[model samples]
Target: MSANTEGFKTFWEQLTPERVAHIGEYYTDDAYFRDPFNEVRGLPAIRKIFDHMFVQLHEPRFTILEVVHQGDTAFFVWDFTFRMKSYKPEVVQTIHGSSHVRFASDGRVSYHRDYWDAANELYAKLPVIGALMRWLAKKMA
Candidate 1:
């Protein structure tokens, strides 16, 4: 395995509220990050995103499924599992997604972009909005 891939996998699989503060160890100070819901640059903003994840979800965890690396870029396919802290806390939810990361010269992540289907993976799991999203999907299909 590439050094970047190994480091990233370890960082993500072991992430926690406490570990969120250690983001700078893996990401550059000016790193860019984007996902279905957020787009932010810099370590502080990136850390906030991760901090919010722990606050909004119950026991959120990531499981790496695959990794592909070439040059300074690595792509990771992963599964994120968690339960909503407020709604159906007992029901476990999983989202399949992928991240593309580019490593800086110092081996820290300089750019990271995540791809996922929020409508199907998240909005469709909500209480009221779920119904609407499902109906819309059916109609569109």
Candidate 2:
């Protein structure tokens, strides 16, 4: 990995509440990101999203499986693990996802996007929709 990509990987792997508050080092002021639920712009807005995610998921953490970079962009293959805020002790629920990042001339991210099968990684793991989704997914497969 190039020095810049290595820097990005280090930033992501070490992300935490305190680090997110200082995301200006990693993202531009007008950076934009789109994912399943929302389209957000600016580092402050992005920080809010991350803040909420970390709050709602206990022990939230990312495990980097791979980092692939080409020129000014990179993809992080990762697995996220956490117990949902509403999780009961008897049940287990964890979320796994990945993100793609595009860098600007200053080495801060200009655009970011995430990829993951929401049905399988999130919705299908829910209590109500899980069983039905599992059934349909199996049928479709």
Please give the CA lDDT of all the candidate structures.
0.95, 0.83
- Write down the lDDT that model 1 would get: 0.95
Error of 2 at 84 (Å): 1.0
Listed per model in order, the count of residue pairs whose N, CA or C atoms clash below 3 Å is 0, 0
True-structure Cα RMSD, model 2: 1.9
What are the per-residue Cα lDDT tens digits for candidate 2 across 52-92? 98887766777788888999988888887667777563455
lDDT of model 2, residue 42:
96
Model 1 misses residue 46 by how many Å?
0.3
Tens-digit lDDT track for model 1 on 1-141?
788779899999999999999999999999999999999999999999999999999999999999999999999999999999999999999999999999999999999999999999999998899999989989999
TM-scores, one per candidate: 0.98, 0.89
